[model samples]
Target: MNILQAKVLKSCLNSEEKVLYLPGNLSQFQMALILAESSKFNSFIFANKYETLARDYVNKNSSSKVKFFLTETSVADFLPIIDKVVVFFGAVTPFIINSFGKIILTCLRTRTPLYEVPHGLFQTGQNLVDNSRLINTDSFYDGVGENLPSLTNVKLSWYGENGFGYPRTVLKDAYPARVIPKFTLVTSNTNWFLYSLSDKRMFYKVLFDYAKRNSDEIFIWCPHPAELLPNTLSHSVIEFRPSNLLLYGLHNDIYFYNIESTDDLIPYCEYGISTVSTCLLDYEMHSKRVNIFNCAGVKNLIAAFNHASAFNSSKEISHNAKIINTGMLKNFDALKFDQLLSQEVSKENFIDYNYLAAYV
Candidate 1:
């Protein structure tokens, strides 16, 4: 069958089943594939016209088991039956959120359960730990003071499920995965804000100077997807995408350092280089060598590698954040993420449908 036909068929079959709400581009969908599979509910991911890449990526990544549907209509259709709705990418703007507030208020007036699973994008900025706040069935915060609208009848749960296993680097087995040459500069996407800011130009400047002075070790720069300009890296530098970097044939004597998203870069604990970001909490759980950077919000991200020597070790941190209206889930923890999902659906209840059938 043709692609459109298949999508239609898929939707028809899953019309009465569980649905998952996701937004953003293809990459968001791709990153969410593993997590979605772990949910207790049989997922039918919804998207918008702008998210074609994400729709295709999720479909491909899950072997078409995960269904896709148009966003608003899908929301209207599924919100009643489904116990929880995860707003993965915040595709729903303030307008939608406001409208949802009304629906939720109605639900509250009638005493029904409604929840939101925000996948990162909240607050005004893009930093992992910026002006952001968690939006669930329970409470809402602007990351600082309590958001006034304080939702009711909804409980806030942690962000992820446990069945996917501890997070690990995706391309871990890639060629240059293990060998971190001394001059290696590992980085995350530059275009997106860690907290609504980009540190690429500043960090790159320091890296460029360091490379010019020490022309001995091969300087390798691994760029983030949000980062578009690796070509401008120093002429003597070796720019490698994660895929190709592993295969380029290099020797064993190497060291590694990375300027990545605080949450993302924490998985790399074996390396001794100190890092700066709230993500250090996860890393500290594994590696004791992490150094916490004290700057708050986007500014710290902009100052990249300015004083590499300033990296300092940190004690375990406790995020005393609060949420409201959560039914069972009250906080962010791995088990909670799983529990909220597992209790919702069972293996036998999941059905496979042809998404293309929806178009028919």
Candidate 2:
């Protein structure tokens, strides 16, 4: 936030008033931290799954005092009294979507203001589905990255730069995955997210087998929260469920970490391994070597889902066939909650995703 905006927001809010924070996904949760840092206030996190990266951010460090809930509607009692509502990212989950709809209605009924901010570009396929549910917002804030397809009626505020500065050093209380001297960053999303590419079982088997075959090189398995969160996609997910024996089978060289963001693992290792993750953009920013897996599957998904206007949609997919490995990476960047700024966006930009969710 700029000096003028912060001052204006602080002045509009009375001493006892509270702010509502609703982050769409774990990675986008960073928007809450940035807002809290700029404006000290109380916050509420909606549907942040247990043990996920976003949940870790709540438990460890935050810019403002925070309390999390199981769903967005859970905050209904608090909404009436809230001075302002800030949706850091867009909502994708069913419960989050429903609750956010309620928040919008309450805001409209009570004359409360809402702000929606963009955490990143609309890389996630749900951009159209999730944003379509949002009928109105009070203000809109644009970030440093690519702008959302232009908004016609609402005023757009430019944040100019992402608050973390460039080349994020570290988040407060955030830690990197533990590793022996030489290890590759093994990150992935569950098959539940990418229904079209049902390869979770095969992905883990290849990872575990590779770990056993190459015990000398360390592997840090940073599984995405989508794989761990409790969900009801059992029937569909069974297609690629990994064997329990493989999950428990330990190769001493392989390890895992419960960190806030996978970016925390970057400083520890140079080269990395993954399937379909936007987090690979972090590696690209560092100019590091990225070992890609399931090149054809990743390409197929891209060709299958790429909307006419998406840019850098799958930055992780290496065009060179030589770097291809034998597994699937997760597309954790599929869901996002824009920053907590309110405004209307050009609805035409949304991709109509009917097939695979593009989930990680």
Candidate 3:
């Protein structure tokens, strides 16, 4: 074995306590932090490109101690110390699979515990199999297994109850102020995949028409981080990039708020619109007024959210478009949800830690 591989093997043999490694996404990072604070784990490590964001979130919103590390480090340097891994999403990329693949091999050899903490949301067709397209092939596994390290498909859980029960008290304590807008357009880059060039033009055209009709209402457009605003739409409305959206200011004309994580933004908007995104479902759960546009494909995905009034075309957007409500939404009791979540947070150990033990 090479020096790095030898080192990993040695570390796996010597270390009795397991450290929890989490992805650097905001939601996952937050959940992992909570787990670390409430568990007997050795240490909580955040691993990903967004180390700065993870630090900012922990410093501002949480009191738990955490270590932030970049994902680009040498695998030998990083994976040796990690005994367990908690990911909100499946290992879908080569880099992710390779890194975790090494850890899996080490853990398997040592008979140590390792686990994947999947996102709490439920999506059809994703949970039927544990292996992703990139990692499931025999050639990929065969090459990696030569070193006696094998990658096993981590299991997934539809922890939807955990979604409703996120500690609202902690969130309220962290972010005290509320910023609400009269009308908000929740834009997504789904147009990149869901709409053709003409369809995209029509999509925005419908929004522009609606904005023109409701000139008196204060409108704010919130774009997804991956979305690029077309010049046509850019010239008409005030656009805010994700970095500058949360400074708290008032504007007269139609504007965009540049903010990361629309979780906070969606709740405050009186009315909302999006072409197909989880944010729309979030808005629905929170009882916010929102609409989904019907693109050419993704009808089944749209139906999964139980949203009604999929605008077949841009021309269908009229004044009455905002008034339509599909009662198919699943709403949680706000007080009960908060109470259950607070109870979970107050525990010495989170329920997720027990779930993690099951894999070990």
The root-mean-square deviation over C-alpha atoms between each candidate and the true structure, in angstroms, is 12.6, 11.6, 11.3
Please give the lDDT score at residue 260 for candidate 1: 28
Q: Each prediction's TM-score against the native? A: 0.44, 0.50, 0.57
**Whole-model lDDT values for every prediction:** 0.36, 0.43, 0.46
Please give, for residues 16-67, the per-residue lDDT of candidate 3 as tens digits.
Answer: 4446565535656656665555445555564555667665655675545555
What digit string (tens of lDDT, one per residue) describes model 1 on residues 1-360?
Answer: 115533335343443446454444443454355455555556656555545655546555655466666656656666566554554322224544543444433333433333434333222212233444543322121243233222322223232332222222232332234443333223333333332222434343444444445455343333333344444332213342222122111232232343223333334333222223322223333333322222244444424422222321222211111111111111233445556544433322222212211221
Candidate 1, poorest ten consecutive residues by summed lDDT:
317-326
Ranking of predictions according to TM-score:
3, 2, 1
Better lDDT candidate (1, 3)? 3
Q: Which model, 2 or 3, shows the larger TM-score?
A: 3
Q: Higher lDDT: candidate 1 or 2?
A: 2
**Candidate with the larger lDDT of 2 and 3:** 3
Counted clashes in each candidate structure: 39, 20, 2
